[model samples]
Target: MANTPSAKKAARKIERRTEVNRSRRSRVRTFLRKLEDALAAGDATQAQAAFQAAQPELMRAVTKGVIHKNTASRKVSRLAARVRKLSA
Candidate 1:
């Protein structure tokens, strides 16, 4: 339990931030899922489009502090490679 008013407020703030971060994370995952689906379907054009769309979402999450920069970069790199391989 929160003992003081300040502690209670902090807890409330944390909850709010958690919700926001969760939403951000979910949004990123949704974008990734779209890309994944496109890749799984083996539609190079659709996958390329999805990849283009997903790249910014990943970077946006990074900028928003929802994900680490390197993590986002690595994801982008791997996905780009998959997209390239599919296209080639």
Candidate 2:
């Protein structure tokens, strides 16, 4: 129901942005899942590697505005703690 040309253009832009954001979010989730699986498997080395991989992806999502800074930091912190515990 976008009557104005500008409104239509804006709707299209939003659609494209939504798709990109969804893709980014999904990618981040996939990385997180990998980390989770590694953790659940109780393999310290694999969990550490997955944590190293996921930390950057989480920060990248934050920089891209797909996630909030504190949210990413908190996730990183919690996951890092779990990783450390596993290593210990």
Candidate 3:
């Protein structure tokens, strides 16, 4: 449906960006899942480590516009709270 040359080019660019964003989102999910698994397994040390790894990835996703900033912050806060509870 992109009749204009510029529109066609923009469509192509969107497709590429969509793929990249999808990949980034999936990677972020993987990190979150790792943290969840570690938490579920009741290993405080491992959970903490996973949380450490996931934090940056989540923030990066926010920076990249893959997810909302507040959503990322809420997730990080909740996970951190759970990690702290594990230690207590």
Span of 10 residues, lowest total lDDT, candidate 2: 31-40
User: Local distance difference test, per candidate?
Assistant: 0.98, 0.98, 0.97
Q: In model 1, how large is the Cα lDDT of residue 50? A: 97
Candidate topping TM-score: 2
lDDT computed for candidate 3: 0.97
Tens-digit per-residue lDDT, 1-88, candidate 1: 9999999999999999999999999999999999999999999999999999999999999999999999999999999999999999
User: Clash pairs of candidate 3?
Assistant: none
Q: What does candidate 2's lDDT look like per residue over 24-82, in tens digits?
A: 99999999999999999999999999999999999999999999999999999999999
lDDT of 2: 0.98
- The digit string of per-residue lDDT tens for model 3 on 1-88 reads 9999999999999999999999999999999999999999999999999999999999999999999999999999999999999978
Worst 10 residues of 1 by lDDT: 56-65
